[model samples]
Target: MIASWRPGREIRYHTSLNEALANPAPLVLALDGGVFPFRGALERLLSEVQKPGVSLAYSSYETDSGTVEALPFNGDITERFPFGPLRAYLSERLIPTGAERFRFAWEYHARLALEEQGLFPSAIPEPLYFHAPDLLPRPDLREYLDSRQCQSGPDLAESFAYLRYPPEADAEFREAFYAMLRRRGAFLEDLEPERTFPPGKGENEVMASVLIPVRNRESFIAQAIESALSQDFEDYEVIVVDNASEDRTRDVVRGFRDPRLRLIENPPGSIAFALNAGLRAARGKYILQLDSDDAYTPETVSRMVSFMEENLGCGLAISYYQLTDENMNPLPDGVVKHLEYDRNNILRCEGAGAVRCWRKEVLLEIGGFDEEFGNYGEDYDAVLKVSERYEVCRVHKVLYFYRRHQGSQDAVQSKAERLNAKTRIRLRALERRKKLVQNRGNKRNTEGA
Candidate 1:
């Protein structure tokens, strides 16, 4: 009879491979014999695979257990005895076999299968079976004890070579053998569905709308979404506009099914156009324009909303942002200056630099964004236009985290594009001021003369 299984306790039982095959709930295999021996290793391995979607598990072992004994499980014997039993339980299963001798067999079979089939199951670091030293066959005493004295030199040299130089020193050696096996076609099984979102009913009322325009960013998209959803501001909506991404960007966005998230597709347009699309659809009193690669702090939206509510005169408000690499580590001593946004300061310094949040009505009243500039300078242009009419405020805390990665528009855009766009807008505004000045000069001359 099988041992009773408890929720938090470990139970030990012996079963033939056939029995294990028939009962297919996830199993953790332990190797009780190898170079390393410990229960902690198995515990750690279990902890790693205990994540929602992963299966196939393992544990560490050492081969020098003080005694030898028979394989614990007994069952019906047939012509295909051990092989049939092994195949029944582990056949087509992508398991990480941990024995020294069996490692070669696993690697060889896995690689061959992968190369032939172009599909394989993952052999992750979980322990599903334990191989005890007592289970190993004893060396034949009668035929092997006296006949090995023929060549001590070559065998000694080979052993020394193996001891000194590990598997990596040989080019023909397989390093990621399991990976090779999975690639070939050894075990092409479907993984159980993994839950990506937190459990619970979602909030219905929208508090804030986060607009993100994505192009070809497939890697950083998920991280950005997680950061947004993780915000302390619960009543928020995330609007993602796909600007014709040729990568897995669509798939990544579709994976998130939060009630707060709404995905919109924009046909091959500029960043400004995509933002405008999201802006049109946004239902929040305030709109937060977050880059697809950037992330906000846990209290970003909440703090901004609270600050805006408390300070009624401020039409737009923004906090400082930390510049980080793709790995989310801060750049060395790299700090971006926070711009002061008083009326006098605005006149002297053009407009607020970098980041800013605005009232949705104010943003819309300023004609949303100048789509002519198309990309880089559009945010600055919109801020400049809005700042001319309303009070812009800068919060002193760092709430936004901007990622500096390759392929970012700021890194790749030409100086000419920025200069041309900025100069055109500035010149146009200057000409209007000049026309006003000329008209006033004419009026003063007529009145004085």
Candidate 2:
């Protein structure tokens, strides 16, 4: 297919390696089974490619998920081809051509290596391409599980979407590859021995504590408070950290005559600050997260607490949640399977726990939530820390309700800010990996001497 915006241009065609070789043009472009609506995509891509030290070039594109995706390119993550349609390659480097520069397996690493041989890969800000994941038949968890292709930790492998391999690769190979990465310290690694909490049955001290951090969420605060108060796990305490709510949130919370509801007021600041305040005052061994605008089912606390108690190694636990509209109406099939535990890309772990419940001591040990991250993506950073140091578990039950409203950060954060925040998160993970590698080297040297 020819990538052109001019009138009467042939934008669609089927070609083989022979046809591409026959073409006299220096560059060959391939598009998914869709039309290229972006006009300057080709020009902009070529311009960047022609730069003195540029190798492969790509453009940011919008995904079917209503998010503008321009994932930060990394060699390790490239092997999985998570780029989806965000990238295009030098045709000669692809399969059946010269060196088979690109493939379903090693496209990212090979092209990135090719760039390293000369100039680096280049990117443009335009949404040059459109690719929908639904266009292809992807294997669901059932297919992966039934295939019996996952011999190594099939439980975790099948749970995550990206880990589900096609029939081409056997279970052993994928599992071995995963083990190698885990050993290399890039993927999920257990925290140092000293970091784990003591294993004693320290009082079922307060059983569980529900932390609700809010500011100006009057309309929703009462429902959230009641949800916490009505949990089947009666031993739990409800600690509401009020962030100077000007709305009727304070009055509504005060209206609750329940003695188990502990309300602490803090100055107007970041949500992290309120969370920290609530966490500091929590008396329970485990903490349940309750946003002012979202609620928990009565069974949520009990179910999540059981999961954590059963999985002693897990530091934090999250579960499937029902996504409802502002009016509590069912919103399509928004079932969350917690696919964030990719074991490869840490970024995918953002949803490690949409509704998080952490071991109080472990949460405190990790320094709790960083007030520096402000309110946006604060939980994500904390989850990443927990995942780095300890295992994160996902309960298959829909124990929580997430109401998608206009006030939520997911609905209000700008595209640029989302990208920027994700980029920062990625950098942090990378830095953590670097430190781990250095520490491993130091330990080896010490042992040798």
Give the per-residue lDDT digits (tens) of candidate 1, residues 1-449: 11111224543333333333234434433221211212343344445345433332222221233222212111111011111000111222334332123322333343333323333222222322222323334454212212332111111111111122244422222333333323422211222211121222234435578888889889888888888888887777889999999999989999998988888988999999999999999887778878888888888888887777666666678788888998889888655554534432232233364346767777887788789977876776776565555556777778878899887887788654554565566545434434544565687799999
Q: Where in model 2 is the C-alpha error above 4 Å?
A: 1-25, 30-44, 55-185, 188-205, 339-343, 441-449
Q: How does candidate 2 fare on TM-score?
A: 0.72
What lDDT score belongs to each candidate, Candidate 1 first? Answer: 0.54, 0.64
The 10 consecutive residues of candidate 1 with the worst lDDT sum are 77-86
Residue 387 Cα positional deviation in candidate 2, in Å, after optimal superposition:
1.7
Best by TM-score: 2
**Candidate 1 wrongly placed segments (more than 4 Å):** 1-205, 340-355, 431-449
